[model samples]
Target: MTGPVPENGQHHDLVARLVAVLRATGGTAAVCTACHAVIPTVDGVGLTLFTTHARFVLGATGPLIEQIEDLQISLDQGPCLHAVHHRAPVLVDDLTPTDPRWPAFASHARRRGVAAMFAFPVLLDDHPVAVLDLCRTTAGPLSDTDRRQATVYAAAAAVLLRADADADHGDGAVVSASAARTQQATGMVMHQAGIDAAAALHRLRTHAFDQNQDLAQVVTDVLTRRLRFDPTPG
Candidate 1:
């Protein structure tokens, strides 16, 4: 995720450009853009757990974004979930006073001090895939200008994600379903050779769990000859 810092002049120039875009469009402070992977480049495929391509966060909205993600994983429902499932934007203007559409989410969000939320789907070839979220602390519908700005950001995110995905796939950096199946088949072959799938899975999981590393990284190690597994004697 780390990269060379931009020269002061270049840094200021970029910030100024963003500020000009936001100001001309009347956007509020606290704007941020994020891609799915830790590294924004296309080569970091399968390195992170981003289901969506990229997202934009604004103002005090960052904390709420984490809270909402946790809530969705806990309560198993919410706008982000819908955005991912149905591939469409989910907008909630007010969290207080209850909204019939998301009774559980509203109650939980209100308790957590969230007032408004918006999620826009990122699309590829007219098919929605990822989500871009925007939020506000104060309770009220998003102003027209804010909505426009959010949409613009979402559009930019969609373009970036599409380009990244395309590049990764084209360069063989991204894993495909067939590749995953092949890897699984290879693993099964090793297991059938008496490697022990459960034990191996456990060992891998244990190593990753103890190291606080990603499961995918563990798998990569196994595939890349960096790690080896030996079955215990029964």
Candidate 2:
């Protein structure tokens, strides 16, 4: 929440390097690559872009990070999505099953070995455009320095995204096929359960977590009628 000026000697150097990377590569992938190289405290970093009609992961430092991003996308809840919605950082010092804020995300991320998570929203023109997510394998709060550096990295991501927009990169308009399917499945669940959109999505996410199945798989089953949102699930 506090903007630490990146002018300290080391942070200043990092900012320069990030700016160079953005100029050279000009996308979220480049931002992730730079973060992975410069920051060694966290297990991995991920970038998710949110546009008016779509949301997608632009890049990640590792496969697990990619999975985490996808999981959040599927469930429509997590630090990243929360950060975007609130337009502020979401920092979970330690992930626990008892955390009620994101019940499904916390349990699944713990199962996947994520013990701490931080999400910083990237804003452009005063609107959130993306989230920079950092996942740690150990449970603990990030050092103040690490938090500041992460904030700097998020700022750089915003710059790169703005550049991509100016160049008509079309990344913002890119919708994931999985996301489309999830939307359809949510609609079906709404109809079947006689619930509103929010309740239907929550029901779908709850079923996925209860079955220990991937949300994508759950959505597939729903679409194919293998799973139903009846009072007693079939």
Candidate 3:
């Protein structure tokens, strides 16, 4: 997903603003807020920090976006993973069910009403450590200007993360918190569907993909009693 500079022209002022904001604040939430101020085309912003032994959801603008990241974590696939693994941006201008790259992740995100997705890896000291992601509710790739600005934002995130690594509470704490919630939902699936843990999780992932809904969302419904599994696909 590479492109030429946008015809509308460069917004260097916005890039400066983002860098200043990231420097002013000590957290990703503040950085996201700053992004919303400068970038008008994006709907949500997310960050994921990866280490050799653990992976964590660094920060995000809201619950929807956090869940989007969680879905990828649960399934271990998607554009975000691709970007992290390849150390390049994964830009899906128009996300569609026909795409086979991320069978489960793509379908669920599509159901969540995400029309476009972009993920860029963040590096510090020449090693990749995090991903900066953007989700668009409207269908299309980010403008060249927006994409360039995203790279700027990603750089800021990488710096802040390394500067205060101790503040983050090591051991994948952020991701582990979300993972615990997922396990609760998984247990619900097992009980309602009368299956083992592995089977129940498989059922949840399959059901979400088949229905084009997010895995975390389906799990939420089950926990809330809004949905139930009958030991059979329906």
Highest lDDT model number: 2
Worst 10 residues of 3 by lDDT: 169-178
Per-residue accuracy of model 3 over 1-234 as CA lDDT, tens digit each: 466653433434544455566666644545555655566788888777777744556566766677677678667888889998888889988988657988878887888888888988887776788888888888987877778778878877765666567565443223323455656777887888888776776677667757867656787788889988887755
Query: lDDT of model 2 at residue 151?
Result: 82
- In model 1, which regions exceed 4 Å deviation? 1-61, 169-234
- Best-to-worst order by lDDT is 2, 3, 1
RMSD list, candidates in order = 13.2, 6.2, 7.0
lDDT per model vs. reference: 0.48, 0.78, 0.72
* TM-scores for all predictions: 0.47, 0.69, 0.66
What overall lDDT, based on C-alpha atoms, would model 2 receive against the true structure? Answer: 0.78
Q: Which prediction has more favorable lDDT, 1 or 2? A: 2
- Residue-level lDDT for 226 in candidate 2: 93
lDDT of 1 at 140: 62
Residue ranges of candidate 2 with Cα displaced over 4 Å: 1-17, 172-234
lDDT (C-alpha) at residue 229 in model 1: 61
- Candidate 1 residue 145 C-alpha distance from true site, Å: 1.3
Ranking by TM-score: 2, 3, 1
- The model with the greater TM-score, 2 or 3, is 2
